[model samples]
Target: MSIMASRPVPRDDASWRRRRLGLFSVCLAALLLPICFSGGAVATPAIGAALHGSALEMRWITSAFMLAFGGCLMAAGACADAFGRKRIFLLGVGCLLLTSLALAFSRSALAVDWLRALQGVSAAATLAGGGASLAQDFDGHARARAYGLLGTTFGVGLAFGPLLAGLLIVRFGWQGVFAATAVVAALALVIGTRGMRESRDPAATGLDWPGTLSFTGALASFTYGVIQAPALGATAPEVIGALAFAVVLAVAFVAIERRVAHPMLDLTLFRYVRFIGVQLLPVATSCCYIVLLVLLPLRFIGVHGDSEVTAGLRMTALSLPMLVVPFVATQLARRIPSGVLCSTGLVLAAAGLAWLARTVGAPDTGVLCPALWPMLLIGAGSAMPWGLMDGLSVSVVPTDRAGMAMGIFNTTRVASEGVMLALVGAVLIALIGAQLPDMPGAVAPDVAREAVNRLVAGDMHGAMARAPAWGEAALRSAYEHAFATLLDRLAIVTLLCAIVVFACLSGKTRSGATDTADLGEPSTDTATP
Candidate 1:
């Protein structure tokens, strides 16, 4: 390494000030991006009407952005490391700002979807290297503080996005939300370009287009099948074809990663069980997370007859823990026992689901009681692993392979989330089939059709398309049943994740001796850090 590669200059007022501004830039971008990732789930009823799309397509609106956003992260991260972190991050913010502006003008579903894809591209470029940037700028103790702050910012983003979206959609309509995001992104971009310093570990990066393409294709193919499987039958020719393509592409991704000079991911990260397992939960946990996150809002707006503002506010209550717990957890992360944290939190998450299930049959406000405690637990539990898992995921790899390892880590979480959401949607579809007023096989033509048609035509904007007065009665019943069933599934996943984490830490107790030496490369994901 040349002296230039590790340059040291005066660290003064201007340098310090810009670093602070850069942090602000990254955090704002992080918050803005998730709204797109969430796909207006909170405002689905109204937005669905405005966009002239069905309830199902609303799910896809968010899911599609996740694919592009989370799917192509490795390539973006590598680009950051290769070209320069500050440069790529700024470029991503620019793209996000432009796409948000474009989205505000979008009329058709396709246009919104495409702009979101662009948003994902920009988000990945800006965010993948963000944590590393913080770690770079601050001293050791301050690095941890910065991490806690970053987590708080993300929690706030995740917490308030739906709430904000819901209110914006109700007061000014959905376009207002996009307009706000555009403004936020623009502000972040300008600050980042002027304030952020460049960061690169020159040795960690090189062009790896083939690796990027193969991995992305695998994720894209699989996610497509998952998203389509519930609406289109799993056995449908197109669904089957996508599934097949996914398998083949995934296998080829592994093979190419093995032979490439600058492989996008190092295949060896899996040897460490902790990183491997924690990443898996993001997928599994996310399945339940997405369902509840999407479903609660739907129930509030569509079934309970809450206004979008009211619905969004209730959901915000759910996200409050997501905002607060992570910062505190990040601070205690080094000192606390991860096993206890994850185990207890998982229990809390499961309990929250169970409580939610029990209260599902009640009106919207009733569910709040059971829902509140669990939200806190789930948020705290999930936050415990973020710093530890991420730290472990990359530190074990060589500096040169860090980008690929981070990429792999992120992809696991994102891809798993895609699969889990698909799974839940399939289950929900099956449940809905049974609940329909007519024969189960005939979905659109069922007895529910004429009434549904009125809603679809925008006649029942206030009354959930004039669904029966008993509709809440019926819908709440379905929610109770489905949510209970889903809670059981989550319990199983939580237990499994806990068991896996426990098994990985079967003997080792003490933490903090990071395994950095003699470690090899990581396997997959466009999430290269």
Candidate 2:
């Protein structure tokens, strides 16, 4: 090898300071984004009851936020590349701050939902721009370390969100969650505005308005259709119409993207099987694991009768490993292939979920500690590939398109998790309702619906009070049974996804493969860099 090839690239002190600022700012935003939503899961019961909301309305509180965030991500990414990353990022932080403050004072469920959706859009801007900032400023080992730290920060938010929210909710109610989010975002905005420099794609022209609209329309329509299916029935005209409209918009989006000079998403990237495999990791986990993070806390409070704080603490078994594994995986990637590591981690997750299913089916045990062992395994396995996969997914992409690529990547991930939460809620309610037919007042549809909603919303005491004639033991058994069945299905599906990921990322390819040595060419995203 030539000496020129072996020597490190030179960077001035000012350049180092600028990149460091960008890294710090983006990672802070990443850390706070998950906390903005995940922490609220522990406070759901309080939010629902305080607003006098039903089960479906409560689902919207979370799903609506995710939907808006996912739907706007690509457009936000394009805007970041065309305009400026620092500018867009600061704007997003401002939006986050304002919406969070409004949510803190929101009196109605509908108002909260709207605020949450706005928050999602702001989050989309921050995440898209933040990712682009890191990709634009760093390359080689520095890039790997920045991505690893970002992943770790993201993991910390997911892990600690509920725990922190639990304490806040106990101290100051559900509104405290939103209030806390605002304060953190306010701090980020101040730091980012002072330290961050502007970065954008010099070659980028005007935004792809047509493509952006079509894609957003498709996603929103499809999500609405699925989310409303349980209440309106799958065949209802509204549901059917929305779903059909989504299909049309999706087709239009593809056509527009293919023809446009500056497309929002570059479809050509999908040709790489490794790219496809890395993207699937989020989807697979969403279907098999992320749903549990939302639902399990409800189970603890509703079924097992644990306090909000206790329930959140109990979840440590599921979240703590993520804090450690992703950071460690950055080092481990040096010795192991990313594909093998990802597949192995997912396999372990599947096994842990299977154990959880069996434990839930025991019918006699009410304690949660028995299941902690499997939860630990599930968390560890899920964390192992996150940093590695995230780095690999963008590293292989042309540096110029990294912003759009990361946006698309995270859009699918967040959107899938949102969709899964809705679907799983629907399924759980259906399973619980199936058991309702044998209970007292089965002939009264309104009574049955109320009972089911209350149970699902983590208001077990209220559910029992509302249905005194219905035996407590029977209600408990039915919910436990439904939860167990859900876990069983998740375990099987996750295992299958792991196998598919392993196959796609297994073999070497001419372009690149999923290993430590394949960081690819230096980014050409910024003309001056």
- Among these predictions, the greatest TM-score belongs to 2
Query: What is the C-alpha local distance difference test score of candidate 1?
Result: 0.64
Shift of residue 324 alpha carbon in model 2, Å: 1.7
Per-residue lDDT for 1-529 in model 2, tens only? 6998887766686678767777787888888888877776777788887887766677777778888888888778778888998888999989999999999999888888888899999999998788778777888879868877887788888888878888888899999999998988888888787767788989878578998889889888987887676666668899999999999999999999889876777787676566778788997888656887878888887667777788777787898888888878767777777778888888999899889888884533433577888888888888876656666667555555565566668777887777777778878887887875464444355666667767877877667777766767878878988888888788888888899898877753322432323323233433211
Q: Kindly report which residue pairs in candidate 2 clash with one another.
A: none
lDDT of 1 by residue, 398-431 (tens): 4555655667877777666655665665665555
Q: In angstroms, give how far residue 406 of model 2 lies from its true place.
A: 3.2
Kindly provide the TM-score of model 1 when superposed on the true structure, using C-alpha atoms: 0.85
Relative to the unseen true structure, what is the C-alpha lDDT of residue 444 in candidate 2, on a scale of 0 to 100?
Answer: 55
- Provide the overall lDDT of each model, using Cα atoms, as 2-decimal numbers: 0.64, 0.78
lDDT of 2 at 76: 85
